[model samples]
Target: LGNQAKAAMNAGDLVSDDLIMGIMAERLKEDDCKAGYLLDGFPRTIPQAEALKVMLAEMGETLDCAVEIDVARDVILDRLTTRRTCSGCGEIYNVKSNPPAVEGKCDKCGEPVVQRDDETEEAISNRLNVYNDQTAPLVGFYKNEGLLLS
Candidate 1:
């Protein structure tokens, strides 16, 4: 699921249920996951969680826990607002502390580093608002199932 999500994110697309489920199906067949596997950055929405539940049920498995990384909205906004990306290599950097070797330049490709329009405070705030409104319920959903750990 992490790989699928990373691929979708790198392709500038939203991670969908089909992609995540496909990844999970493939992973569950592997010997390493026969016992257990820890999930990170998955089940971002209720629908995705439900899809994962169905897949796990078919596999005779269930989630043991779900943990939330608690961070303040202001900190998230600060981080997002300071984020920059290499125009050529797509390497992300933080302007606040992790600036490139050459200011406003890509350390890997020496290309100019640019702030994405979506990384602006306004855009990030809007995205956070939507996430809180639409996806925050997953916390309660997991809690109700006694799977929420933090």
Candidate 2:
């Protein structure tokens, strides 16, 4: 999953569900996550959510809720397209909101800060399209399970 993630991101593609689920299963078994963990953007599809249910059941755990922070699509597009990251230190910046002191340079690491390939407008649009098609249904899936907070 680790190796495939970079290639997928570079291609503006989602990682295969099996790879993600496998990694997530292993991760949830770690000591730190044994207590609990916040999965920011996960279980994007109904199938993944179902897999999570089975996985958690096997672990004697259950998800409390799924929180959806709804933002306007245009706002999401603008935010992602303007996002930048430091090549060295991975500091985040935004062209509109939070820019580095030196243009195109990381304020902390003095390394080049540039837009990620996956953050390009076209790439983001593609991602949003995929999300709309494949991930949006999870809203209804979680809602039906009484675990959704939108």
Candidate 3:
């Protein structure tokens, strides 16, 4: 799955729906999910949402709600682009909000804190375009299903 995902991402595409649904189906069978689970950044498309409905129905369950964090694209771009991660400790910092004590250095491990390749302005802009084209529709889909919580 990692290889497939990497390939897709490298090609500037989302992972195939089949791969995601298969993983989700198996994951939902886990003991912890029998009660309930909080899924984030999933069901990004209407097809996936429908697949989830079928999957949950097969398990004799139903979705309660879908939460949407409606952030503006400019805000997302600014926030994500400003994020820096420690190479050693994986600590996250934001240049605009919570910069490291020593600029470009991690306080925890003294490692370089750098912006991730995927968090670059170009990369984030491309991701925002993809989200608008593909994932944004899910908001209306969930709303029509009476499952949206914005």
Candidate 4:
């Protein structure tokens, strides 16, 4: 599900709710997700969160909890700035922290790796602004539902 969102993000664009929902619905219906699944990088918007509730209700399932890792924003900036992306496969690597086994090449796909413009400081600042505006509210939203764990 995150693949589509990642493709959108890699191009410096915010993924639309429709694209996110489509992929999420497909994954959630799969057999592997029946027992349990750990979801990350989802419900980035209030609409997505609301729609997820409706979908889960239809499936007779509910989120057990929403775990938030409360990291400082500056730390995120420092870490994300070093990220590089694979052109063939959208795998991410942090040059200084988790470099690929082969420098400038994807370890999994053998593709040329390059830094995404989206991870530039200015671009990351823009994304952070959007996160603050549209996504931060989710923390309180889930907290009110008694499903938030930090």
Best by TM-score: 3
Count of clashing residue pairs in every prediction? 0, 0, 0, 0
Model 4, residue 45: C-alpha shift (Å): 0.8
**lDDT (10s digit) by residue, model 3, range 9-40:** 88988689888888888788889987788998
Error of 2 at 5 (Å): 5.7
Q: Count residue pairs with overlapping backbones in model 2.
A: 0
Candidate 4 per-residue lDDT over residues 9-110, each given as its tens digit: 889787898887888898889999988998887888899999999889988999999987777889889988889999999998999999999999999999
Q: What's the true lDDT of residue 108 in model 2?
A: 98
Which pairs of residues have clashing backbones in candidate 1? none
Off by over 4 Å in 1: 1-20, 30-32
Model 1 residue 4 lDDT?
67
TM-score for each predicted model, relative to the true structure = 0.78, 0.86, 0.89, 0.76
Global CA lDDT computed for model 2: 0.90
List the candidate numbers ranked by TM-score, top first: 3, 2, 1, 4
Q: Give me the overall lDDT of model 3.
A: 0.90
- Alpha-carbon RMSD of each model: 3.6, 2.3, 2.1, 3.9
Q: Which regions of candidate 4 deviate over 4 angstroms?
A: 1-14, 86-95, 98-113
